[model samples]
Target: MIQKLSNGFKEIMIETIDKLKSSDKRIALAKIAKTYGDGGQTAVAETFHVSRDTIRKGSYELESGFPITDAFQARGRKKVEKGHLPHLLEDIQAIVDGQSQTDPSFNTTQLYTRMTIQEVRDQLVLQKGYQDADLPTNQTLNTKLHQLGYHLKKVQKTKPVKKIEETDAIFENLHATHEAYQGESNAVRLSFDTKDRVKIGPFSRGGKSRVRVEAADHDFGQTFLSLFGILDMSNEHVELTFTASKVTADLIADQIEAYVHKLRSQQEVDTLIINADNGPENNSRRTQFMKRMIEFAATYDIKVILAYYPPYHSKYNPIERVWAVLEQHWNGALLNTQEMVLGFAESMTWKKKHPSVTLEENTYETGKKVEKNVMDQYEKMIDRAKGIGKWFVEIHPHQCKAALYMGLKTQ
Candidate 1:
């Protein structure tokens, strides 16, 4: 019966490893090593036909409390195209030359070829008069094609339906505003956006580490956390706030309120220019968020200029880059608790400076739309750009609401 059970376990291991991706297979095998103890490494190695050293390394990773998912990374031999395939790149490029999109308007030089590696091989063998022995296998040919910058990519789902005529003009305006704000001593320029949502519990994330760490078996939706971040353009300083509750308009407004208040304590900020994309929670049409912003400008007695980037271009916002750096900082480590997540974020450096992290435990109500009557009063304080109103706005203090129209620069 014991022998039968051991055989069943080996079958299960084989089946499980077959179903998993490369990194995940290592993690699963690591877990099994941990459970079996002393001879666990040997048992797993024999069952899986992997070297004992690989299993022993996994076991060590499990004990060390780091991540070992990428332990076997770059383990295989270099691709043939890198060294062995002398004429492969030139030959493949010639075949796909006609498919190149030479249009200057297109962002990239996209190839339109749909031929498979086998077809390519046949073409080289028959037309190019190369012997079958001289040609590499189809798999190697495919890798060679990729090394030559060819890919079998699917079309993007969200193609721009129509070009916004004023997109370039808006970007030009943003550049001018940023430069103008930077020139002033008492003025501030900031980029605002929400970072990638993270699950609060221990979960396996993509990255490589020297040791392996165990995470939760499954990811549940309820444990996710949203982070709203603001990047100070002048000093390269970042501020982060964590919200277990959904990222709502009111929440964004509150964070802005807190940020402006903190700035007021440091210096007498005259003009505040903020750059952000038109996200759902803080768009120009988001009355609640705008209402709070207008109130914030008025209370701070500063002129607030909201410079929005074009749709589907969140990368233009400087805050997005900050999030990328933070993600890399804690990619492999297991963020098991709220404190762990906050600690990791606080520890990440941008321009040799770490950000101040604040946890917003206060839950705000979602889908809270402002009343039309209240919004109408607030609208008078906001002046949007002509033809590109969604991409730009100026909010004046309550008392100086008429300032919205005074120097409205639509250029």
Candidate 2:
């Protein structure tokens, strides 16, 4: 076969011979001997640029195959740290499980020590008395660590709020108010809250879009857009207002005022049930928010009922689900300017109705509050439910409206 081989075949074998090892090299020579039949070894050695004696040995071995026990025991590169580098695996585990044994945070099962592969290699050499040559490459170490169930992961927040004793009672009150509003034709239940603050400049948002856009390298405290939103549960209507100011009590009150006017213009809504979280701006105990709410009730001739969810339960709000939809809709687009942000928000549809977009360029000052003495006089109109007063409050139009209007008139 070697004598019959073309020059091209001989050249290809010469190029590949250096890459073959052990049994592979012998197998190539044995195949040539089988093809040649006689003087095959000499013909193969001369044609393929190999020693004649080496080819003869391979031919004899091919003719008389050895037993399984006579074959080589091991092949390939040896293990990196053969002699159990003395507590190396245990130390790696210790570093990977940092502070988790004593202090744990949120809903993550895996603890991260934030140690790199190079750091691990250095630690082994410096502390464990292991030579540099014995340590495997970083890639190999990473694979080994993964095999041992250690991985690099970010921390997640899953810890719930401290269990409230009156959680059931609060939920019941919320349900009763919802049902009451649902049954009344003159009532409007609006889920009132602010969405996550978005930075004005180019920033990365979650999700994929058809068009590719790049975000800023860092999210500095540049300009930001605050969304004060209200979702009417009765008609599934959404009202979103954009502001460049902090989400304060004044801002919340202003948003409520606009929402009230819009609803009254469309139909008769004598009662406004506002569902929201117990955030600082809209807290039941916030005197400023209470004062503004009473005036809001008086101006619109509508009774206001504030129903707050338990702490850390903001996800239960109906508007929260709408906000989630809006987030998903614009996640892929680049919101580099306020116009883009507003455009994306207006384009997103929830329940087949696009939200009414209003730009509130009104520069609202933070920390604006009514005097304690004046607020105390109007507090009489605010009625709180017994035992769970902080979670429920009712502001009657007849009670505080006169006092609030009088005060405003004097101002």
All candidates' TM-scores? Answer: 0.58, 0.61
Error of 1 at 112 (Å): 19
Top candidate, metric TM-score:
2
Count of residue pairs whose backbone atoms collide, per candidate: 3, 0
For model 2, what is the error of residue 142's alpha carbon versus the real structure, in angstroms, after optimal superposition? 22
Name model 2 segments beyond 4 Å from true: 1-162, 402-411
* RMSD versus native structure for model 1: 24.5
Best by lDDT: 2
Could you give candidate 2's per-residue lDDT for residues 76-158 as a string of tens digits? 65554444554667766665565232226535454454567787778767766778886767898887677656666556676
How well does candidate 2 score on lDDT at residue 173?
Answer: 96
lDDT (CA) for every model shown? 0.76, 0.78
CA RMSD (A), model 2: 10.1
Task: Encode model 1's per-residue lDDT on 1-411: one tens digit a residue.
Answer: 212468777677588786976546666677876777777767777777777776666656666766555656478876555655666678778876665433334676645456777778887777667787877788878877766666664444455635477878888888887877676868888899987689877777876667878767787746777999988886777889998888888888787778878887987787888899888998889877887777678667888899999866677888988888888899889888888999999999999999989989999988877788667766766788887788889876754445443543210
- What lDDT is reached at residue 68 by model 1? 59
